[model samples]
Target: MYDFYKTISKTKIDIVYLGETVCSKRKLLRRDDWLEIAEQLKQSGKEVVLSSMALIEANSELAAVKTLCSNTDFSIEANDMSAVQLLKNKPFITGPSVNIYNPSSLKMLAKLGLKRWVLPIELSKEALSDMQSEKPKGVETEVLVYGRLPLAYSARCFTARSHNLPKDNCQLRCLDDPDGLLLSTQEEQKFLVLNGIQTQSAKTSNLIMDLHELINLNVDVLRISPPSKHTEKIIELFHKTLHKAYSASEANRALQKLMPAGGYCNGYWHGTNGIDWQETTEEILCQLS
Candidate 1:
């Protein structure tokens, strides 16, 4: 992901989420640092959000959650059930990592003061439509429009252990590969990326060209996960398309230059394999050109 302050200052992004969502061990930015960054982002005319860690284990981790919940300056996105419990009776954004699979759960969270939710990487358009149909009043839906799908998180630091070290003695190996260390099959085919304890897809999930479909679904926001580089260009493409200044094909071509590879997919949204891409039709391509 890009540097939080650098990105917020550079882009016309509507919302900026700060905090370590992957591994809490990543202490490059402390809680106070996040709050400071949030303050800076607020001044930049963006809605600032603090994202809770996806995996919370120890009491210290729980304490971090408490601090964020108690802070009244900005809203926080609860990623775990513990965070949800801590923030219950108070309004907060429910992140995709939470188990919000159906309308009942959505309503329950809404009752608990959840005003917004990011759709999980696995949810399809049909499911989203069904949930949106019965959403509680004032609840908004945001989709994981782009990013390396964060598949799973573990307590063990796989990246550290790979270099023959313990979790506590990880020695900040993760920083060496800012985008996570890639893992390939025995046959040399690239697969997953090891980011401390978080496992992400090797291929980044890009959805800039799916603006039409997202608008049709009535999605309120399209979340682009922070990339290590070229984030400004990616956001600009989306910013242009969101305002009808750029066509889908133009956005798609711009994204090719920003991805780790030329890989693009929207299979999860279409209810197919997660790696599938719904190709642009001839008429749509012609119009874009």
Candidate 2:
């Protein structure tokens, strides 16, 4: 992924999140490897945030969290409350998996030295507006503006079960499914993707269509979770949308071709179903015209 780091460092995205934020069992990169990649990203003039593992179940995992927290050089993305406690008094960012649903919780985290907070993907735009109304100063808001939505995490490895292998003995087999192991419904419709212990939505949440609303909400950062393919292209598309170089409909058209087979969804943004797609007024007008 160092090659990916080099590619994104040249993109228009301001902040880059490094480090593994999901299952800790997948040890593709060590702590030093992450720091070295962090240096490379920082050298390319990008703000780097070290992301922590979301589910820390073992004592060794806690030890890893301690190591990441003590780095002191780069800011960290607190994925769990334990991480938050470790990050107290330090300027750190909160990942979307962190249950920061209410304004009271937001205020409490702000007091604990949170520099920024990623909106929980399930929270609607209206909910974010209400929360942002009472958000503390100096705490920036980041939206999961692109990529597959991380729906859930579990201690059990579903991918291992697929191979009929025990979780412990299952070789790092998930690496074979780079994007994720696609889980289809009984109806054969593409449902969710299993990435180790994390379950992600099959539909990519493309919010280039909602850039206006985000800007109006005063969202500080727009986060695009990396997919296996077209990572740099997606970043460039977001850059174009952010700069008003492409209208939402035009960008949506261009983006549709780039999406994975399951396609895009923004139903959560509209406060509806998570997996459904809701079209914009422009797209509707285009359809009629």
Candidate 3:
């Protein structure tokens, strides 16, 4: 894990989100370990944010959230309401899991100390423009430009269940599939990915082709959810594209080769089926308008 952070630290990624946002049972790194990593990343001139789990089911989990929220050194990305409540009056970020769907919700959270909010994965680009227009004075907007969309989270451990093991006694099988265990449809079509309690899109959400639209929308940040492999290259691709060193088309083609077996999807951003991919063209942009 240290080596992974050390490697990415040299990349053009500006902000590094640390800590486990999924199942609490995956405890290879403790709170101290995360803080140490955060320190190292900060020392490397990268802004670090500690992320909390999406679903805080137990008292132990709630306690863990409290510990993260109390950290004076780093800001917390509140993934759950419990983390949000604990982080009230403190400058913090709301993760993608927290539903800030409208201007009203954004306003409410901002009043409670929302420094920034990640647009929900399912929201269309049109919706983002609307939110941005009414976005508060000091708050920032962040979009997940890349990664497999984290669709949902349940108390149940799907990874463990797949292995025919109960949640409590289940071995930490999620480690075996670091990216995620891909699930397929009846006809053997790639469907969704099972990562413990979280369900993610089988196809990666790639917005390399839509960087122009995002820039036009006045987005504050472009987030790339780190996959297990080729993360440094992915960061470099986005960096070069963002800096105009590489055109979006060239970067998009390069990204295709780096992605896993499942193809790419950007339909959710188009306000359509999440699994479908639509090429960004002047005609398509006009229709969206």
lDDT of 2 at 42: 90
Clashing pairs in 1: none
Candidate that would win on lDDT: 3
lDDT of 1 by residue, 1-289 (tens): 2264766577878898788888777788767777777887888798998888888889988898888888888998999998889888888898888978899999999999899998878989899999989999999999988888888888889999899999888898999998889888898767788999998887788777667778888999889887787777888889898887987777887787666853667788888988677876758746644
Q: What shift in Å separates residue 150 of candidate 2 from its native position after superposition?
A: 0.5
The TM-scores of all predictions, comma-separated, are: 0.94, 0.96, 0.97
Name the lDDT of candidate 1.
Answer: 0.83
- For residues 1-289, write the lDDT of model 2, one tens digit per residue: 8788888888887888888887787888888898999998898898989999999989999999998888888989999888999999989899998999999999998998998999998999999999889999999999998999999999899999899989998798999999999999999899999998899999999888788889888999999998988988888888887887877778888888898968899999989998988878785544543
RMSD list, candidates in order: 2.2, 2.3, 2.0
Tally clashing residue pairs in candidate 3.
0
1 or 3, greater by lDDT: 3
Residue pairs that clash (backbone atoms under 3 angstroms), model 3: none
Candidate 1: C-alpha RMSD to true structure equals 2.2
Model 2 TM-score?
Answer: 0.96
Show model 3 residue runs off by greater than 4 Å.
Answer: 281-289
